[model samples]
Target: MALPERNNEGFLENAWQWDKATAEVIAAESGISLTDDHWEIIGLLREFYKQHEMSPPSNRLFVKAVKEILGEDKGNSIYLMQLFPGTPAKTACRIAGLPRPTNCL
Candidate 1:
């Protein structure tokens, strides 16, 4: 499928344009291979956006949300860092086609 339009940071310009294929393209551009674990986080991010109309504004908040939904083992910063590397909240939101977190650099 043709890729959707994306911003300079590679986030989908229109959130509605997001899909698994779009996410794959974005992740590939970032040199990430999307495993099932990655998909779980992506799904969680999307659901969070749907409910809150925004991405988590910080790693602490993201981790807390994950912990509430997915439990401590998968929700910690270490697991997220391993999955998205660098800034986990920013990278995951980008790949999930959500807006960048408010306070992220």
Candidate 2:
């Protein structure tokens, strides 16, 4: 029931690292182009974490999110999968600068 510890390298080592400046570090490491849509999702993830203090479930990540802010139309998992297939859920969390999720383990 516990969450995974972030990479020893340090979670959110990228854009949001330990502080807001860490987001720059994350940007450099991600090597992927983060667009406005991506920022929208990441910001939502941060807000979700702030409210729940937990990562979203991978299974319903897109579904759960879209309904809340951007609406159900944007809740497709395909976009998330296409965007960060290598890490999909995990990398999304990384880009969002959140701690690793429990299911990711």
Best model per TM-score: 1
Q: RMSD of each candidate?
A: 1.0, 6.1
Per-prediction TM-score to the true structure, in the order listed: 0.94, 0.69
* Poorest lDDT segment (10 consecutive residues) of candidate 1: 7-16
Residue-by-residue lDDT tens digits, candidate 2, 32-78: 67767767777777888888877676646645675567776666777
> lDDT of all the models against the reference?
0.91, 0.62
Q: Candidate 1, which segments miss by more than 4 Å at Cα?
A: none
lDDT of 1 by residue, 1-105 (tens): 787887787777788779898899888888999999999999999999999888999988999999999999998999999999989999999999998888887
TM-score result, candidate 2: 0.69
Count of steric clashes across candidates, in order: 0, 7
Candidate 2 wrong stretches, greater than 4 Å:
1-6, 13-21
